[model samples]
Target chain A: MSTTEAGGRIAIEVTVNGTRHRREVEPRLLLVQLLREDLRLTGTHIGCDTTYCGACTVIVDGEPVKSCTMLAVQADGAEILTVEGLARDGELHPLQRAFSENHGLQCGYCTPGMLMSAHALLARNPDPDRKQIRKGIQGNLCRCTGYHNIIAAIDAAAAAMREGK
Target chain B: MYPAPFRYHRAATVEEAIARLVEIGEGARALAGGQTLLVWLKMRFDEPTDLVDIGRLPGLRDIEQEAGRVRIGALATHARIARAPLARQIPIVGDCASGIADNQVRSRGTIGGSLAAGDPSCDWPVLLTTLDAEVHCRGPSGTRTLPADGFVQDLYATRLEHGELVTGVSFALPGKGSAGAYVGFKRCAPAFPTSSVGVQLTLNGDDCTEARIALGSAGLTTIRAKAAEAELRGRTLGAGVIAKAAAAAAAAAEPVADQRGSPAFKRSLIDALVKRGVEVARRRARGETVEVSHEYY
Candidate 1:
């Protein structure tokens, strides 16, 4: 087994939003900080230190992960997607447009995380029912809108994506 | 918030991980997905001198079937297990894994970590106990197996020693005429279970010959409903019999009151969920397809 030096800052490499980054960081630096502070990707916001809030959500290796709770060093050699990576050359992803047109955001603090969560859900289901969509984003806590618009955004995105295909 | 300063070591193999744990002695903690440990660290609830990261260990994240048993590596993520073909064959494993936290958590959290953490409200232990699963552990001394009943000792506690690491869990697959289901009630926090019930039954020509019922978030540790199992054994698994068995299971639970629910409310949920779980299992056993109710939303 390979072992790195203990009790010292370590240099690690990670792929974030289609870009490769190598940096030296403390063992305790969270992935959220590395994204926002180090890499200057402020799209991912931190709402709560606790994992309950989904504000720091990101896609790691094709799955949603809470950036606040994950150590930056631990994510070495992994593929990550922040909210900024959702668009393709200025074309907004269907989910993002759906959120905007359907009024899925009130305070907008939870929008990034909500989009990531919904992105993962649609990637797997393509066409999910109301309950599946609701359960898919259950981890994301939205204080405003009561989740009716959020669910509608996902539903509309799913329909649009299906139709576009 | 930053976690307290601690030494970190990443172990690429199971043996190396266990050796690191032994070297660090009692102040060492193993990190898998870090979903739970990271929270404890940020809160300063625990400050271990050394952390042994076992996420890089190969072959520890697989689900396989051998003969009549299904083996799941301790490192298998909840999402992987939930979507595993073998889990679908067993039914209960998939059901329980599907209900844990949500998409993100299931994608990162490992089955082994959750089982080793032994949170009373976690769904894996409750379902494993009902299915008579076996936990396999490895240490410097060698490998050992513990029955599910003996693996979990208390809330947030397990029988794992200082140098031990969970390698895998194995259990017999449900037979042709057997079925299993897990039902629970949750509010606000989707990760934690308020009251949960797991039921597995074997049907022999419309008669329930074998039954196992386990309830979680109702006691210090997940518990088996012996009286409820007895009530279902040797009887036809109809609505009336299932209701009686559910009542027996609920009566046997010793739930504690908390903000999520009161003791009495938990008991009532136990009764309601157990009946539904058993009825669902029975329907599956009979090869009848039933859609899950979306009434709770």
Candidate 2:
């Protein structure tokens, strides 16, 4: 079997949100770049090359992942969900609404990752305490809001989600 | 930034992965969850010519409990192991997994990869050493099992040869009255453990029959606190005995100063964490409920 060269492009198949996408990408293409450049889904922001900042966070198969750190080939044949796909049928996700209403975001650069991280938290735990909420967003770094409103937003969203169910 | 150029091969089976490793020889690296390797790649620390992706390999993602021991496959993600029924039943493994980096890291990191990477700061090495775990590796020469202590040779180094893949790790189940705990201290943000201690104690009618203490981030590798274990062997679980054992454990640690913490601070932290770990284990063994103070996410 002939192997693709290092700098050559290779075919990649990945499911973003619920849509399947097939594209040829460079071997060095990051999952973040693939989502932003190839697919034109820019909800996943890239803040730092280091994994410290969770600005490029996304849900891959029910788990929150740092998209910048993972290569596009690594995500081949995997299910990915970005922040843009959170809302359904023109309605905002409860977390999104909570962030807006509770002033969870300031500059909004970290909101997408924060929302995605919180979505994973709510999926695992519909009702999380303040400590849990803090732990959930520990990977996401927010410079503007100081995380006070973010924590409150998650708490309120949890309550809203529980009430809705 | 993107990683340096490298050929990628997704192996469908363990045999295929091993074969690919053999083919690629020294220029190949196995990809488990890519939590650490990807970071290193992006930083241009080390570039491999080929990446043997083992994420799809079968039979390397389960947690099995046998007659005498529990077996954890190498590809088992930390998240999966954290939620594994057998791990929760065992408790120590679950606690250790739960205490790893954070939700994002745990979700994408694998126990096998972490242990194989042989980082002294990781949680599994310390806990596995304390539990006397055995690491099973598969190579061209067939399969072999090495005791966890012998498996890790030094910092970021293992006894594993080229083309060898860690298949699984096995450890004996804790006895009826045995309990264990992993305690550590970390600074703000990301919450990497500055100094961590793993303690396991087996009790017989309020007296400790066996005790094992392992300290991580205290040296080139996790060190067993033999003197501390000896101190607690015949003594009843109490604050005084715990303090003595903790002091011995701290004295045994030989840590270096790093940005996360200082040598003196880490040495002091060893004692505090070991004391806390032993107290927590003893309390749990006595069926007493106590809140554990953990700062890490």
Q: lDDT per model, in order? A: 0.85, 0.85
TM-score of each: 0.95, 0.95
**Candidate 1 stretches greater than 4 Å from native:** A1-7, A163-165, B291-297
DockQ numbers for every candidate?
Answer: 0.63, 0.60
The residue-by-residue lDDT of candidate 1 on B1-297, one tens digit each, is: 678777788887788899889987988899998888888888888888878889778999889888989899999998898888865676777778877877777777898888888778777888889999999999899999998875778877899988899999999988878887888777744447888888889987669999999998889988899999999999987879888998999899999998878889989999999888888887888887644321133
* Model 2 docking grade: medium
Clash count for candidate 1 is: 0
lDDT of 1 by residue, A1-165 (tens): 444455677778999878999998877889999999999999999987788878889999899888888899789899999999999999999999999999999999999999999998998999999988998887788889889999999999999999992
User: lDDT tens string, model 2, B163-225?
Assistant: 999999999999889988877777744556888888899997669999999988888888889
The model with the greatest TM-score is: 2
lDDT, residue B107, candidate 1:
79
Indicate the DockQ of the complex predicted as candidate 1: 0.63
